[model samples]
Target: MIRLMFLLPILLCLGWYYFLRVNGVPLKQGKRGFIYILAFSTLVLGFFVLMMHLTNPG
Candidate 1:
């Protein structure tokens, strides 16, 4: 789980970049694209962590 937490961000970011490229979103030419990916990945990680904290049964 600890390792997964670290890997999830990279996977999420790459997946987002790929999604954008598939739709022809000019990632290399715009700073905003990178920022959007970073923000999206962070939000997903935050939500994952929050859910883990809330659902711990121990």
Candidate 2:
């Protein structure tokens, strides 16, 4: 779970990077859209951590 959790962000970043590059949204992701992404990042990371800890309580 830890292994996959880490990879997911990397994949999401790559996908976002490519999407921005193709759309010319700049590397910063624009100020207005940042908040939405920040929230999403928090949710995704939080969920991953929670799930991992819950499933592997060793």
Candidate 3:
């Protein structure tokens, strides 16, 4: 689970990169796309952390 949390963002970013490249976006545009992916990944990771915190039966 811990590993997955880290890996998910990387895979998502790679997919985003490929998608942009396939659509003929330039490297500059791809950089911007990466920034967007990073921001979105951060939000997703934060949500997962919050959910984990809420559900832990400590």
The lDDT per prediction is 0.74, 0.70, 0.82
Between candidates 1 and 2, name the one with more favorable lDDT.
1
Give stretches of model 3 more than 4 Å off: none
lDDT of 1 by residue, 1-58 (tens): 6547677667767776788789887767655756876787688778888988999998
For residue 44, model 2's alpha carbon misses the true position, in angstroms, by: 4.2
Q: What does the lDDT come to for candidate 3?
A: 0.82
Q: Number of the top candidate by TM-score?
A: 3
Kindly provide the TM-score of model 3 when superposed on the true structure, using C-alpha atoms. 0.70
**Per-residue CA lDDT of candidate 3, range 1-58, in tens?**
7658778768878898788779988878678778877888789889888998999999
Using TM-score, rank the candidates from best to worst: 3, 1, 2
Cα miss at 54, model 2 (Å)? Answer: 5.3
- Which 10-residue window in model 3 sums to the lowest lDDT? 1-10
Candidates' TM-scores? 0.56, 0.52, 0.70
- What is the per-residue lDDT of model 2 for residues 1-58, given as tens digits with 9 covering 90 to 100? 5556566556666776778888889876454454565567778889877887899959
TM-score of 2: 0.52
Screening candidate 1 with a backbone cut-off below 3 angstroms (N, C-alpha, C), the clashing residue pairs are: none
lDDT of 1 at 43: 87
**What is the lDDT ranking, best to worst?**
3, 1, 2
